[model samples]
Target chain A: MTEAATTRRSRITPEREAELYEAVLDLLREVGYEALTMDAVAARTRSSKATLYRQWGSKPELIAKALRHNKPTSLDEIDTGSLRGDIHAMMARSDDCQMDRDAALMRGLFHAIHGNAELHQALRQLLIEPELDHLNTLLRRAVDRGEVAADNPALDFVIHMLVGGFVARDLIEDRTVDREFLTSYIDAVILPALGI
Target chain B: MTEAATTRRSRITPEREAELYEAVLDLLREVGYEALTMDAVAARTRSSKATLYRQWGSKPELIAKALRHNKPTSLDEIDTGSLRGDIHAMMARSDDCQMDRDAALMRGLFHAIHGNAELHQALRQLLIEPELDHLNTLLRRAVDRGEVAADNPALDFVIHMLVGGFVARDLIEDRTVDREFLTSYIDAVILPALGI
Candidate 1:
């Protein structure tokens, strides 16, 4: 525990904490990770620097946790019975606007993640691994039910294809990723690769 | 043309110009696009700042051109008479170390591209479009040969899949993309999706 945590633990309510995380994400979207400052977060959230530091310890910790908080769905809980259904449900969880915001936020984080090892580790721990594990479970269920081949190589690239779909939208066509595009991509590229 | 073009367009030899571009790319890999400066390029290449600015007009133009210069293969020129062979040749154009360096350089550029509209336009015009056109030609040839159906929806995602394969390697498995990995991915994921 840093100086802040030892002084005040659990002082802020969960509702207030969520608001703080939202503020962090808002700043991230507006200015990106490199330009974002602890001072800015404190001012945006109307919280003391001491409180912010006490709660999160550092900027990477705060940013990583904020990203985690922004994820509205727990992927592990999404079970639609079929692999196709599950994948569609996962994409449908976020609407068009939310997906756009998420894409920008992710683009903002990519540079910081590349430069900062601490941020990278935090993200892998707090954000990426959990989601990967959840998706793995979803795929494992597909394999169990014989919806997909157990030894299929395309299985390894499912995440890459999905992520590339999201990241490439702006670069390829200068378009925003929406549920409709993802649905078509799922139907066309992903399913065909999996031999579904 | 800027003052550089009018003043002395052909003063720098082709070999010297290539050396300058290589220095710019080395600086990009070291300090990233955000921090790269004309002064640094001049100092590193033993050229005057005025000459550097006059030649390239701006950092974005220089960086974009450097990236184009660094591409050892004219992807358009790779005609192996088979889509698989063409792709494998594309991946094999650079050795393993070059791929890792290119990946790092690309990761560096991602943040700069997000923030700088000017850099983004230069990159799109000078770097991305040419490559896309080349890949499209390759795909078109494959269509002509009946290796892949023209109407296949996966045709639209071919670039996205290949790019995702490059970008996602570090993100997912923390691995440097090599010829073997890309070859396997092409055989397993891309080829199967194209129904080859």
Candidate 2:
């Protein structure tokens, strides 16, 4: 409704968009998805509702973009010549995974994501798949280097255990998943399970 | 509010309460937590809102109780002597860890649990901690039986691996955590990590 007939659009600079995404994630951490509204987003970003809608179409798309923005791109860059080294590096990346903000963001998404098909698919596709793919690539390299058995059945779910440990640590155990904990986890649980 | 003037209340039998819990879990699976309401529960159970309010006092308590009621109590009774047998039995218990209903309940609770202090506390106190205690007891027995090292560092996070594996199986991996899969998990990942 902001523009019914005009095809021309004012281009938003990447810097502007980045600021907007940050505002969205902050609001997501504060209010969560069920309570998150486009009006609130527009107000926080100091932008028009029509502009927001035109850019993202819906709340799920906006939230998904925010999550994608926050995700670290170090997966492809992780190379330490050994599977053990790669795992330690991957687990130690200083992303918001261990931060309170990321935990809040995850908790915000938990309940609303169940019946929300668009949100579920968006999260799996954007956030979950890339991490899994990276793990697969790492394992493949290990196999190539003859460091691991190619047909080890544990290889299939090894990523899930690591990922879920971090995911459930707080929610289930009320324990903080810090770097020290993850490094110990890598040495004790992960490498041993991987047949080191 | 339904009966501010009435001081007298009718006591529902344990059987009726179980039926109501079943109804709550079913509605949770169907409509999820946000869309689920006391009215929907009342209608589903053919009961009055006042009755539910009197029983659990709130939605979170009701959900927490339902989870507790559904939990497998055989954890205390599972004594296969060896730690490996105990873990295998624990993992393979057929409470439908893969069933869509339980998954839906988990999904439904994911986002709603955060920022909801009442619900969060209810889940931890009523559901999560009991399971953790059961695992602890099982491990303690194993330690005394000399089946596992008393000072093994891996014993600390071993529960996390088993738990995180099941929790993330469907959501993260899209694979079923079946008996055969868990059996292999016990052999390949669990035993090796535990040095069993």
Candidate 3:
């Protein structure tokens, strides 16, 4: 919201921003959101807390910046020529590459989102909304490709279930994400649920 | 594991155990798992911490006892004579009764589970195993009645999805359980996914 905050990100080179964001994520994984202080982040990155505060007005804003900057590029536009292929590609991407530090970072993010409305909104804006938008784009492309019905009632719920199931399984069961689980989920649940 | 522990539970009447467990849960909700000391529980219940320690042996054991004792009863064995009717009843009961303290208690349990392996095992034994057992019972009954297939691929996944979905929705979306959402979920996703 502050002018310095708005320009701080722009002033930094893209590579430096990525380095700082990665540092923040590493701290999140190490200490969690509650204990993640800007001063600690500044110390970790060898920057001053004043610089961080100038860049991001609050902890949530700082976290939002980190999350937004580190958004997974695994969901790149994969045109597999069919909805099933696209879905499988997406699920496989989720199971393989997307479940590493992101899942652990999200656990911390979940705690942050619980008690802070501002953090929750920032999460929605920085993390959830972009992912949802990507999924919507994929689904819309499927509709365009005629691989699925345009009136897919289960689209949103399917995406929610997939992501929700993975996170819940990791958090609750402490299990590694298996490709078999994801593919079976897609084949048995999401595909049929969508009447594909 | 201690003789004193068994003797305490057996010697105390069921009503007394219920009262004590309720008090423990109240304390858990108030102070969270890390801060929930036997001393606090004793003070809250007008008993001594020694009695709590003698009875439960450890904090994890005590918390597990509280969770087990306070678990919601499974939906009445509905002889509604149809799988859909039975599932609807079960889901409705979950939406209405199992949600209030269960949500807060689960959050506390998650925090405890993350911190202590012994507590995690105790919680799984006390909380998760029982619910999964009940679900298995319901599904087995449905299979026996010819309402659902014995080899339903999505059976296990369905249970996980329902529980995971509800917990994730409640925690993430901050929405109370809605009957319509449950019913539509059953119709749109669960039943179909199970090949019913």
The model with the greatest TM-score is 1
Model 2 lDDT tens row, B3-102: 7422323477768878888899888767666668999999999999998898778887788777666654445488898888887777666555544454
Going through the candidates in order, what is the number of backbone clashes in each? 1, 4, 0
Candidate 3 per-residue lDDT over residues A53-154, each given as its tens digit: 877778887887777666545557777877778778766665455566655666555545656677666666655666677667777888787866777667
Question: Cα miss at A26, model 2 (Å)?
Answer: 3.0
List runs of model 1 lying over 4 Å from the truth: A1-18, A38-58, A68-72, A125-127, B2-5, B8-21, B35-72, B125-127
lDDT of 2 by residue, A57-136 (tens): 78887887777666554465788999999987876665545456656766567667655667766667755677788888
Local distance difference test values of all predictions, in order: 0.79, 0.73, 0.69
Q: Can you list the residue pairs that collide in candidate 1?
A: A4-A54
How would you encode candidate 1's per-residue C-alpha lDDT over B78-194 as one tens digit per residue?
999999988777668779997877676766676677667766665566546766787788889999999999899999988788778877777767677888888888988888899
The 10-residue segment with the lowest total lDDT in model 2 chain A: A1-10
Model 3 residue B97 lDDT? 52
- Residue-level lDDT tens digits of model 1 in A1-196: 4576545656888799889898998887777776688999999999989888877888888998786665545554888789999889877877899788877776666657766776666556655677678778889999999999999999988888887888677676767788989999888889889988
Looking at model 3 chain B, which ten-residue stretch has the lowest summed lDDT?
B103-112
Cand. 3 Cα-lDDT: 0.69
CAPRI level of candidate 3: acceptable
TM-score of chain B of each: 0.78, 0.76, 0.76
- DockQ comparisons of all candidates to the true complex: 0.55, 0.49, 0.35
The interface root mean square deviation of candidate 3 comes to: 3.0
